[model samples]
Target: MSGHSRLVELVPLYALDALDPSEAASLESHLEDCEACRAELDVHRNVAAQLVPDEPPAIHVWDRIEAAISQGDEGEVIDFGAERARRRGNPFNWMLATAAVVALVFAGVLVGQRLAFDGLSTDEGVVAAAESAAEEPGALVGDFLVDDVAVARVVLSKDGLGYVIPTDALDTLDPSRTYQLWVLTPDEVAISAGVLGADPGPATFTWKGDIAGFALTREVAGGVVSSAGDVVSVILDT
Candidate 1:
């Protein structure tokens, strides 16, 4: 892959702060002049922000951090003053510090597993499916609107794979509720696509046969076999 293509592939990892130092530096430099990549970065960042729980980090996470700090390697030596001054001088260092703290909190919950949103795993394969669908021929893209105002976008490919990317206009629900995606048939039969989390993020689903459009509903967490919630937004297969 070319430089831009390679950087584009790293966008997701960069969003997660999973990129190595050198790769991140290169991508950050490229992002300054690449509007497309910057927008992609924003989308990934938004999805990540929505995934973080609103509640404060668990107490045990803090305890673990304290324990680790107190039990530092037996012979390890560090210059705390220099490290503090360096961090103070570089804003980016502060951002990295925050990211590290957030990572620690998330580690307690995620434990190296892929995040499962609405029964659908947002794994690399699923992300690749969405990217592939976007590049495929005969792919349909449309907006899901509420009160005629667009709140989310949906993509449906010829091979029956679909992806949903929500906008900030969509409200985040409480722990008791979640957003659900449904595939609607021409006859108006609704098929469950997946249960999106309380704060809907990018999601991938699969469907076979013809679909009239797509709908999003706010349902109880864990979702329902049959939707008991009202449709919040929809995109017609026009």
Candidate 2:
């Protein structure tokens, strides 16, 4: 496999220390520059950490494992069909059972990570996420318009994580006021997505559920729970 693809596949195994030294080193090096892979690794690591139960298994669990090991030691013909049937019937194969559970948990975590924002706090990371979202199949892309003229652009992923990129069309506001982003729902309720600075640049925010559209309003500095200011720009879902 290619470098990135190989590294991504190794992430879950790496979290469990299943990779050899060389493989681990390569994955670590690749993670330094790849934010998305790093995020995936983080998710896998978190799931692995949570796998340890608060209470230890009963003595019967250990007895079952020992019995399975003893049965493996006998020098008998290794028949693949019989082994499969044995494993299916054997309740002592706790290791295989545990592995299956871990696999299911990791699958769920990967799906959730894809839908949930990775919490990219830096400007560069936010821009990268937005650009990545723009390339996604179901991403919503549009322009924020004022008086029929475009003032800003937005790229919202299907999961509702999005970024707003402002243009020179929006003049800088006074120190006492700031640009606030509102996520409008079908009910016309305006939810505050984020507060952009007086001179807006590229910024990220997350909104759940259905979004009817988006709007930028000039509000008091630090923003407000309810907007009581001028609407600067609007972008409706088309």
Q: Give the number of the best model, judged by TM-score.
A: 2
List candidate 2 segments past 4 Å from native. Answer: 1-125
Please give, for residues 15-123, the per-residue lDDT of candidate 1 as tens digits: 8989987887788767757889988998998999999889978999999667545644431221222434454543222222322111001122323432222333234
Backbone clashes in model 2: 0
Q: Candidate 2 has which clashing residue pairs, if any?
A: none
Residue 88, model 1: lDDT of 58
With a 3 Å backbone cut-off (N, CA, C), the pairs that clash in candidate 1 are 118-195
Task: List per-prediction Cα lDDT, in the order shown.
Answer: 0.62, 0.63
What is candidate 2's lDDT per residue for 129-160, written digit by digit as tens? 77677667667666665665556667777787
- Worst lDDT run of 10 residues, candidate 1, spans 99-108
Query: For each candidate, what TM-score against the reference?
Result: 0.45, 0.47
